[model samples]
Target: MTGTSPKHDVFHAIADPTRRRLLHLLVDREMPVTVISSHFPMSRTAVSKHLRILSDAGLVKERKVGRETRYRLEPEPLLELKRWLAFYDRFWDNRLSVLKHLVEADDANEPETAVKPIKPQAMDPLSLD
Candidate 1:
């Protein structure tokens, strides 16, 4: 839902869970339509449609070698997502660092105590009011 750009369209295209899975499958291995469909319970046509969406998004690329159309993942679009995520990653790291310092200081102020068995004190319900 960001501004339209080449990479923005690519991110939108791969936003779907199914499409993302397809990209992951194609990451290291180039797979055919039938091979990709077998990993999913959906029909071959449905898989093909998802592949088409990924292809349109530039998250994946397809090539026809003889009878089978092979699909491969394109990582260039993902770099954008990683870059966006990196900012948040650094932000959280700094926040956690401050928290760690506060927690260490707190632990320094408190000494560990031996556990003592507790006897339950009976409270009269009449006194609760």
Candidate 2:
């Protein structure tokens, strides 16, 4: 392993918008750096740097073909992220369901009323009435 810090997590790899788009582009099929660079306005070198981060995070796999390097999406690592998000999804769903139930129950107990206007108080500071 290189002397790089072990700060390369899947979350960190996908944190950048460019890197996320790169993953989306490679989702269907493997593509070479040149083709992938065409989808973005950045330089090929910048795209390569993003790919390197994804590679380090295990979100992508690189294969060398003749004179070019191809990259493919490695989605297994993202399953961990999906599972993490799904847990919170369930938590929020349960909480929201309970909230809905409470609101509906409260509405059922209260009767609907027409709007009422308050009459002005006849108090005069000067006449003491």
Candidate 3:
């Protein structure tokens, strides 16, 4: 696929814990499937399947090194995920600001001694009186 979009979206590919771990493993350097598979408890085939999904999402790139294929992380696709999460950050910030304003307004109307402290009472468990 020269200029076509990826078959899998970054969110879908990263939704699985296994796939996320695969991305982390390939982040620093490229390694053959054998080396990558050794890091996980699953079979080499299983690890290959996870790698395939990541590749489809454009999160990782594979290269032919002699007779073996090596994979490395391509982090450009993760920008989409980061952008999506940033929107929620701004949303929560605005919501928290409104909540803080409402709480301060209510506190200002209350008297300083409005809150009364409760005294602890000791009781005897076996007392009949």
Candidate 4:
């Protein structure tokens, strides 16, 4: 009910590929629904629905220019997504570092040996013996 919070979060809004593509399209510039729909294979109503979801998530802003409505990327909500991903990035980095250390330690403890290749015995293609 409060205007401070969005009806949908950034994650839910971007879950659909169509909505994600809409964000990419609106990133550089604002475009009306008709112009935006032209880039997609669906009807204008479908694009409008995606835009509505993005608007509810605060990922895009809509402006009224004369008779047409234009949409553009807001970008601020994406900071939450970036922060969430960053935590996982650091987590994986630490895990990889530990794994690397373990592998190197194991390698250092192994005895070095010359590897010899085994040769196959000659056999006829039709022989079952």
Candidate 5:
């Protein structure tokens, strides 16, 4: 079977710091390009390019409002990412649980070491220089 489209994968879109910031900006509410660009240090055109990548990835949706285009987060694509991470999380959890049990069992089987008393050594008698 063929693999999924590169553009639709959430990982590729979120790899860039700028794109991740853009997604965070859109989280609370939808915003126009001008408003979103204001939050970033880059040019408005650069912001638009990032937004276009987000749109292609299915992570954001765009709506034309008269002469301007507004963008909002489209979270459905992120569900796949969540599921992928959750699978690994469970895998690591199980491995860690097994490791903990092994350590506890080893501790139970080992004999405890008794604390030894420190004996002060007597000073050696020697001729004074």
Candidate 6:
């Protein structure tokens, strides 16, 4: 019916390298906006704009301390990224295990000299079952 939408604001926000860097600066501890902006050559306004994007993504929290605003990274979305990565990791593990088992099986049944280089069969959809 409709295009898939992300559950929250986190994914697209961290997609940019600048925003990721901003998050890295805040990961260690809360830092004021000026301190964060000083790390880059961009204008203070640019840093503020990046912070707004990060705030909308939920990857960072912004709070005012008297006269200055402080930013800190919120790592829950990073955990979600790790979980998504793990599924692909398991998929690769299973495929590699199957290939290893097949190679072992071939080695057991055939003489070392008799076994030639194994070529993977390209499956043609029209000819495949």
User: Candidate 4's C-alpha lDDT?
Assistant: 0.95
CA error at residue 116 for candidate 1, angstroms: 6.5
What C-alpha lDDT do the candidate models reach, one value each?
A: 0.83, 0.93, 0.94, 0.95, 0.90, 0.84
Sliding window of 10 residues with minimal summed lDDT for model 3: 120-129
Candidate 2 regions with alpha-carbon error over 4 angstroms: 1-7, 106-129
Who wins the lDDT comparison?
4
Winning candidate number (TM-score): 1
Candidate 2 vs. true structure, TM-score: 0.73
Per-residue lDDT tens digits for candidate 1, residues 26-60, read: 87989989999999999999999888877666778
Candidate 5 regions off by >4 Å? 1-8, 99-129
Cα error, residue 126 of model 6, in Å, equals 44
Clashes of each: 0, 0, 0, 0, 0, 0
Model 1 misplaced regions, further than 4 Å = 1-8, 114-129
- lDDT per residue for candidate 3 within 1-129, as digits (tens), equals 566898899999999999999999887899999999999999999999999999999999999989999999999999999999998998899999999999999999988886789998787889865
lDDT of 2 by residue, 23-48 (tens): 99999999999999999999999999
TM-score of 5: 0.71
lDDT, model 6, position 62: 84
Residue 105, candidate 6: alpha-carbon lDDT:
95
lDDT tens string, model 5, 73-102? 988889988998998998899999999999
Error in Å for residue 91 of model 6: 2.8
| TM-score winner between candidates 2 and 4 | 4
Error in Å for residue 102 of model 2:
4.1
